[model samples]
Target: MTIDDHKSHLVTLGKFLKQFQVTGSKKDEEIPGNDRFFEDFDQKIDNAIHYNGWFTRENIIFALQQWSEALTPQNLKWWLGDYNLNQSGGKTVGIVMAGNIPLVGFHDFISVLVSNHKVLVKQSSHDKQLLPVIAAYLMNLDSRYENRIEFTKGKLEDFDAVIATGSDNTARYFEYYFKGKPSIIRKNRNSVAIITGNETKEELAKLGEDIFRYYGLGCRNVSKLYIPKDYNFDNFFQAIYEWNPIINREKYANNYDYNKAVYLMSEFKLLDNGFLMLKEDKNFGSPIATLFYEIYSDETELEKNLEEHSEKIQCVVKLHPGKKEVKFGHTQKPQLWDYADNIDTIDFLSIL
Candidate 1:
């Protein structure tokens, strides 16, 4: 199939996804082939949540909505406008996905296919249900995708290049295993927010979304805070109070309780709000329901330190600091062009 054909199929799939939302699911008459997919779509959403505790209904719906917004014809055209897909010796690309959040590796899956390459996906066991169902929908939209898409539960073989996401430890294994082939092996990274003490309450409230969304499971979620020294957290606490309902979830509550007890037993000073805990830590990867914080005396030095350790950072959230940074609350909502790890997947596939 041509590139236009692939784009058309994906646009149709996007319309199908738009039918389901957090508020409710509706059948769109304009989207053809929904008769076969609509019923199964509902079941897959349920199965995804049942299989993964982090895949709450709200989170699943948010992921679907993001995909739906991203897969539009205009968006696809714009995102792929500069790439040349005319040279058509496509290779099979293998993907080892991460299950930290729902559909986390979907961008890689689509990038390979959109670049005219076949995709062999080894999904995380925690997120096995959702992507295959969407792949089936794409196949139904066009039978050509059936030959282009694949899933494997066992060892991955017979692929030219590979993309794998995992912790730093697994990255060593991926690097050793795929040393002979071209690959993109991702390691653990975390996002952090820089608080200037002058942010409006509305902005801080939105920052709350960046911190707590997906129950703070995704890489893009802000796990650390860089605040001004002697900054009072009363305003921050009051701003994030709306998300108190998150504590009601059993898994998150269990983590809060367990982590709190551990900190108390160790005599670590902590700021607790019944649901969330804030601790003075220099590490970026904070535990679930807990946020690590460090005080910064100077913004210039902080920027220099962050630049020196750029590899450990996934994204830097800031408010109008004049440099390229993700706006508040937009950490999780990456656009089609926002390649993870600052590595261009489309460019990688195009050259292959």
Candidate 2:
């Protein structure tokens, strides 16, 4: 299929996804092939929740909504506009996906296909349900997509290049295994929010979305906080109280109970709000129900320190007026052009 054909299929897929939202699923008959695919796709969402405890219906719908917004004609054009994708055919790209969040490997999947390359995906066991349904929808849109998308059960063989996401440990294996091929090996990276004392309650509340969304499973979720020394957290706690319902989830509550007990038994000082724990840690990756934080005396020094550890961070959350730092609550809503790990997927594919 040509690039425009791919774009049109994706735009239709986005329209299908737009029907499923956090509030409710409202079918729009205007989308092509909806009659054949809509009911099955709705059922698959429930099947996904049944398969993965972490994949709540709300989180899955949120992911769908984000993708729906991203796949618009305008967004897709802007994302691929700068690249000369005409040179981007005749390769099979293997993707080793991470199952931490819903459709986490989708960006890479679409990147390869939109660049006119075939994709071989080895899905994480935790999240194997949804994408194939999507692939089917795309294939229904155009029979050509059937030739472009493939899922592997054994190993990612017979591929020219690869993109893999995993822990820091698995990265070594990916590097060693794919050494002969052009690849993007992604390691563990966490996001952090810089809490200036001046942020309004509204902004801090928005920051709560950054923390609690996906039950803190996504790398884009802010796991660490950089706050001013002697900063009072009373307002911050109050602002985030809207998400207190998150603790009601059994898995999250269990983690909270386990981690809280471990912290108390160890005599580590903590700030507790019944649901979430705040620990004064210099690390970026925190546990499921806990948030790590450190105090910064100067913004300049803090920026330098973060830059020094840039590889450890996925993205920075801050409320600077003119600076391009990610705003509060928008970490999970990254634009289509916001390439993960600052690596340009299209650029990588176009050259290959």
Candidate 3:
């Protein structure tokens, strides 16, 4: 199939996803084959939550809505505008997706197919349901996709290049295993926000969404804070009070209680707001229900330190646009062109 054919199918898939949202599921009669897929999809959403406690209904809908907004004709065109897709007899690209958040590795999945290469997908066990169902819907839209997309439960073989996302340890394994082939092996990275003691209350509230969305499981979630020396956190705590109900969830509350106990036993100082804890630390990857923080004395020195540790950071949120910085509230709402880890997946696949 041609690239235009691929684009059309993805557009249809996006429209299909739009029907299912947190408020309600509205079936659009204009979408073809909805009658066959919608019922099964409704069940899959339920199954997704049952299979993984973190996959709540609201988070699933949010992920679907983001993809629905991203797969538009204009967005796809803009994202792939500079790529050459005319290569014949393309190789198979193996993708090992991460399940930290729902549909986390979908960009890689779509990138391979849109670049006219066949994809061999090895989905993370934590996220086993959603993508396969969507893949079936795509095949129903165009039989050509059936020949191009394949999912594996066993070892991945017969692939020219590989893209794998995992922890720092698994990344070492991937690098050693796929050393002979062109590969992109990703490791653990966390996001952080820089507070200059000047952000508006509304911006900080939105920043709370960056911290609490998907229960802060995704790599895009801001797990750390960079604040000026002696900066008061009263405004930040007040702005994020709305998300306090997150503690009602069993898993999150357990983590909060356990981490708080550990800190108390160790005699470490903590700032607690009942649901979340803020601790002074130098690390980026904080545990659930906790956020690590550090005080900065100078902006120039802070920038230099952050740049020095850029490899360990995924995103840096700030009020103003700076180098590799995202807006306060926009970390979770990434655009279609927002490549993960600053690596261009489409560009990587096009050359392979």
Candidate 4:
């Protein structure tokens, strides 16, 4: 398929995805193949939630809504506007997708195909159900996609290059295994927010969304906070109370109980609000149901510290839009251009 053909099919897929939203699923009769695929896709969402407890309905729908917004014709045009993909394709790129959140690996899946390269996907067992359903929809949209996309439960072979996302440990294995081939092996990275104590309650509420979305499973979720030395927890806790219902979820509640127990047994001080726990920690990657925090003495030094450890962070949330900093709650709503690990996947594929 030509680039425009790819764009057209993806735009159609976007429209189909738009039907399933956080508010509710609404089928649009005008969208092609809705009669055939929409119901199956809806069922797959439930299957995904059952297969992996982390894949909640709200989070899955949220992911779909974000992708629907991203895959528009205009967004596709802008995403590819600068690349010269005319003579660049037919290579097979293997992708090892992480199962941290719903549809987490989808961007890479579309990146390889949209750039004209064939894709061989090895999905995490935890997130195996949903993407295949999406792949089937794409294949139905155009038969050409059938030849371009393939999924495997076994080892990946016969691909020219690879893109793998995993923890720091698995990344080492990927690096050693794919050492000779062109690859993007991603390691663990966490997002953190910088609270200056002047944030409005509205902004803090939005920040709560960043913290609570996906049950804090995504790398983009704010796992840590960089707060001013004298920052109080009252405003922050009150602002995020809207998400207190998250505590009722068994998996999250269990984590909260376990982690809180461990901390209390160790006599570590923490601020708890029944659902979320905040501890004074210098680490960026906090445990589930807990957010790590550190008091910053100087804003300039804090920025410099974040800069020095940039590789360890996926995003830095703050009010200001400095280098590599995102707004209060937009970390999870990254645009099509927001490449993970600051590595440009499109550019990587274009060169290949």
- Local error of candidate 2 at residue 130 (angstroms): 0.8
| Clashes, model 1 | 0
> Which stretches of model 4 miss by more than 4 angstroms?
none
**lDDT of candidate 4 over 1-352, digit per residue (tens):** 7999999999999999999976778999999899898898999888999999877889899899999999998999999999999988999999999998988999999999988999999999889888998898899889988999999989899999999999999999999988899999999999999999998888899999899999998899999999887888898998899999899999999999999999999999999999999999988999999999999999999989998999999999998768668998799899889999999999999989
User: Per-residue lDDT for 236-349 in model 2, tens only?
Assistant: 999999999999999999999999999999999999998999999998999999999999999999989988999898889987623447988899999988888989989999
TM-score of 3: 0.98
lDDT of each: 0.91, 0.92, 0.91, 0.92
Error of 3 at 280 (Å): 0.7
Displacement of the residue 272 alpha carbon in candidate 1, Å:
0.9
lDDT tens digits, residue span 1-352, model 3: 8888888999999999999989889999999779899989878988989888888999999999999999999988988778887883378999999888889989989888888888999998889889998989999999888998999998889999999999999999999989899999999999999999998788899899899999999899999999998899999999999999999999899999999999999999999999999999999999999999999989899989988998899899998867568998888889878889899887788777
The true-versus-predicted C-alpha distance at residue 156 of model 2, in Å, is 0.8
Q: RMSD for each model, in Å, please?
A: 1.2, 1.0, 1.1, 1.0
State the displacement of the C-alpha of residue 279, model 4, in Å, after optimal TM-score superposition. 0.6
**With candidate 3 superimposed using the best TM-score fit, by how many Å does residue 304's alpha carbon deviate from the native?**
1.6
Reference-based lDDT, residue 224, model 1: 94
Off by over 4 Å in 1: 321-323
